[model samples]
Target: MSDGERRDMGSKLSFGRGRPGRTAVTLPDCDVPLAEMPSPSLLRDDLPLPEMSQPEIVRYFTNLACLNYSVDTGFYPLGSCSMKYNPKLHEDLARLSGFAQVHPLQPIETVQGALALMHELQGFLAEITGMHAVSLAPAAGAHGELTSILTVRAYLEHRGESRHKVLVPDSAHGTNLATVSTAGFQCLPIASDARGNTDLAALAEALDEDVAALMLTLPNTLGLFDQNIVQIAQMVHETGAQLYCDGANLNALLGQVKIGDLGFDVVQMNLHKTFSTPHGGGGPGAGPVAVKAHLAPFLPSPFVGQAANGAYVFEEPEHSIGKVGAFHGNFGIMVRAYAYIRSLGAPGLREVSENAVLNANYLLACLREAYDLPYERRCLHEVVFSGSRQRAKGVHTSDVAKRLIDYGFHPPTVYFPLIVDEALMIEPTETESKETLDAFCEAMLVIAREAEEEPELLRSAPHDAPLRRLDEAAAARHPVLRWQREDQA
Candidate 1:
């Protein structure tokens, strides 16, 4: 049978299979007294709940799980996101009863062990980034960015300065721009020079007494380390403005260099990305912010502090920016990250960066001939390539990404950074083996060949997947969030 016929048969098997009056669970009688029922006006009896036997429900969900892609299932080379493989050991450790089952509101004396873990994690992060203090309160990367910006704002305000503008590189992450505005500051975009570094001339012009901070993403979205970072830091400080480093790309410099040593006043590290915690799926992630001594007073509140008696306690900074989260940020994620650091130590962390850089450059060397290399410099942890050549043959980067699905590999990030035309950004993180990289590269080369010889194949791709290419634009603009039975439809 054809692929379409098979898909139709599968869909038929999936839907409308629930038998009436069937139940998956048998609930025991309630032991507690029941509350009064609400009025009928507040009730709904026509909910489309599925009814199926326990075995059938298990099989259905198992099939659904098999259809999803994850870091554990295959190679994920998503560029800026750093989709690295998470160690199951860390997951098992995080699930321990003491760590997983503790309440955030428990008495401080009872949870000293958990508090000590956070205290030590803070110190480890500070040492890793060479910062004076760290706060484990921000929940995600963007939250960290917002927290850092707010801290800068508070610091400047405390000094009786009213700086209103924050300088952001043109190739910086979208969150940087949004964070600046959300912190009640104007975001000014700085142009990148021909060599893909921040334009020194434009930065000089942009800096003045009104500029609050220069947010720099080291080894920026282009994956090229800025050769003039020290000079840029000097320029920003000359105007009495602070220098903020977006440490999302710290995976490329872990154990090799510290952001604080590079003259940044503040930096935020994504524990989920670089420190090997569970990432994606709108998840429980951590983005702890670290700062130099001068700005440490404004870090988010309730950071772990060590008393002179050697007891761990939550202490607010003198001039803190106030609480950025409901509680000490995602405690489970923090535990996993703590386990990752203690397991790796200093030497292993350095190897992480070394192998990450090596794997990325290997892919760059193998694919440069087939794809367009926008910049001809050595990349740090990720490589950004342009698909303008394929676009010339009437095949776009999104088309190439869709075709990758046919080869059983997740697609790299495409058309991002908003600087390169038809961009295909790939990052083969340290966890991937050379053999996996080779197989992915081979599939890409074959797709490149098919793009030229048979452009139509690229235009309509992923023939083997369970679902064909969807109208993503329409789906985004008009989302169907609820499911309904065929009779209701």
Candidate 2:
């Protein structure tokens, strides 16, 4: 029950079911009749599961889970990645017996409730983005980008075009460009201008019939919404290139602006980011892609549906792209997102975005004097602060981040967007209170001072963490994983 007795300091893992030096279980070496092992090659071969009492098993995992630092536990301001708090109510709603107990392959009429939820979710996403149709497939954000781009390929192919290039801004997330290049297209770089938004001139030069699409992360990596989005969209559209909106920043402009109205031919929503789902350590996430009616046929198959008699069904589109996942797109995550949508409705969702923007801007105000604002514009849900000042003090952004952990704060993503020098991207989501913000700011200022006073301390920080800076070579070369139950063997 207490922290001292629970966590194992040296191992960096908690005392759990098979904890190295814990009296977790007492299974006899000799098997009883029911526990007798089957042959290894047999289809019904027994698993090497431990034998433990109910309370022990429960306590074991309970202690282990606590060792994890979740958004539920504390502040996780890993910017560009909205590590916002996922409400437990969403989990409860998702696990309602009617929903949780159902099998995916159940007949349409039987699971109408689920189908209806999915339909409404699709509708909600479409409404949010101003798109015609949405496909609740594509497991994660990168997956969604791949899905939308593939649809673009299919669309262009239908028009007898064989475009091979995707115009990606220099400041775009690595995943965006990676998805493009991986999808068998040349990734053409469009540089960012002085203000850090996509350089329109570079984009104009990149425009050609050979370019399949231009991908834009709305409220892009710099955390500043592109100023010339309309003009940029039109320019891309002019060259007969499809415009893809990486809706990772949908958290910022949910009800305020629609991507469909903003001229995006395809847009994907990170339901986990916008709708409050835990990033299951890098996710079993939902990135539903919304597109105009013209691209509907190319969507992934087995999308949820609603029958005329208020029944829920799963159906494949006539011109489908086959299956993306086994059943539905991370339906549980989708359920959480849907629940979040229903909980917030329209007005509350808008406030979620409004307050998110307000929070980021407030933090921006707090730090602009102390740090260099990469792009001094009204940011969306996050703001990118350049650690140019700290770098001048012989400390990089990485040092600043390492120092933050010692102050009991998780670091923002560093050296990202690959545009700004020593970028420290921060997203203080709407959930944080002003007091917490003030405390975080105070820590930042203290660190800023430390950067000047004892640069070495900042350079070699996170001394308070369970482990200090790891030897990357040693760690990468030899990663420890899992526990061995010597007693069981």
Candidate 3:
């Protein structure tokens, strides 16, 4: 379109807040401030950047943030991803004077408050998870998994046992499989039984001297808590292997059961998930891994330890896994998590888990009949519904997801928990009210009916969005990371 036409549209009431699309600029003629800042090399010219006025830049980003849906803005029912409302109180507390301004290189004595908070957080997390110690050193959940695996490996290596494989349930998080592989252990999938729980028979068969650990996500990706979990842990123990609980779904069981009491020798919780910290594109996350007393020494340093003089200090573990990240965890994320923990206390946390489970079950009722739920049983904090019925009617899970946009709600996670064909995974967090869930259910059921009555509407969905479905294959094959035009001399 012509610049005049673009400018005309952008001057409207609604569009006035948005910027015109990026206008590519040629080098040497660039009008950005960086264009005047010369390169370090004497012979080189100044760096060229596209020139954008303040208003244009503001409008451009405003439009971009609107493109995204978050727990802060809407109901994000991404199962296993616990996109719960990040309490604003936690954000406020995290940024308090003492917490936010701490320097990483400052002497331990100088940052006593920061150190004490970390020490208390460690103790609180340990008590919550029923572990001997906590290491708020891993940057994110997956990083925590890596840290746990390394610790398990160290414990095994110390005993002169060289285990080669880590048993991963088929229902386990994809990251678990990847983590084990990256940590130099083979990921052996233990298939699920008819009950949507890990197949005890398969796990028993997979168990052997070579298996170092069995990574179990209690309420597996299907959101079904394995009833045989305790027995499964025992079986792993019998085989002389550690039990690693992927506590991503711990939100579903908080205050209900403790994984430590359930026989998880090493476990990692996505503090960003269960503890109500922010989660998104790139984190500021804390994924503190707790371990049975035996694995404590191998934890990442420097763990917060209480000194004799009533001061908290960073002390290295006996057989440390070294530093997981540059400093002690994501300090900012830890602050948020610590705030969440203190605010919710013990019983309050349990209620959060209970309410989360109740919400999921409530949402599931509205969907179970219209959609095909592979496992028709009590779910935890999330439920997985299949779009196989819709797919038969010529609408896919992806199409159904896009159509949800019209209802002013973010779509549930689609095509996940791989076992279910055309899966739509939903998690209505504890914070959501019954009304929001009912609306979500209504939107889902309406979409289900439309899939049958007007397959075309369901097929060519997301009619409201500025962008529509591109040929995904072509887009991926020739990804346009950024916009470009013919070279200008």
User: Candidate 2, residue 69: CA error in Å?
Assistant: 2.0
Q: Cα lDDT of model 1 overall?
A: 0.93
C-alpha lDDT values of all predictions: 0.93, 0.84, 0.86
Give me candidate 2's TM-score against the actual structure.
0.89
Q: Pick the candidate with the highest lDDT.
A: 1
List model 2 lDDT by residue over 1-489, tens digit each: 444453254244332445333444567876655654476555553444555566767776676676677677777887878888889898888889878899987876787788888898899998999998899988999999998898888888877999999988888888988899778899988998988678888888889989999999998888888889999989988899999999998898988999999889999889778888988577889899999988888888877777677666777876787787778878888889988888899999999999999999998989888898877687889988889988998998988898888787888888886888898888888888898788888888999889899999987887776557767688789875656655653
Per-residue lDDT over 1-489 for candidate 3, one digit per residue giving the tens place of the 0 to 100 score: 344433343333332333344443434764655454375556643323445656666666575555566777888888888999988888788888888887899877889988888889999888988999999999999999999999999999988999999999877788998899989999898898888988888888889999999998888889998999889989999989999999899899888888899999999999989998999889877789999999999999999998788888789999897887897778888888888888889999999999999999998887788999898698989999989988988899998998998787888888888888998999888999999999889998899889989988867877766555557899889886753332522
> Model 1, 194-241: lDDT tens per residue?
889999999999999999999999989999999999999999999999
**Sorted on lDDT, highest at the top, how do the candidates line up?**
1, 3, 2
- Minimum summed lDDT over a 10-residue window in model 2 is located at 6-15
Q: Between the candidate structures 1 and 3, which one is better when assessed by lDDT?
A: 1
Best candidate (score: TM-score): 1
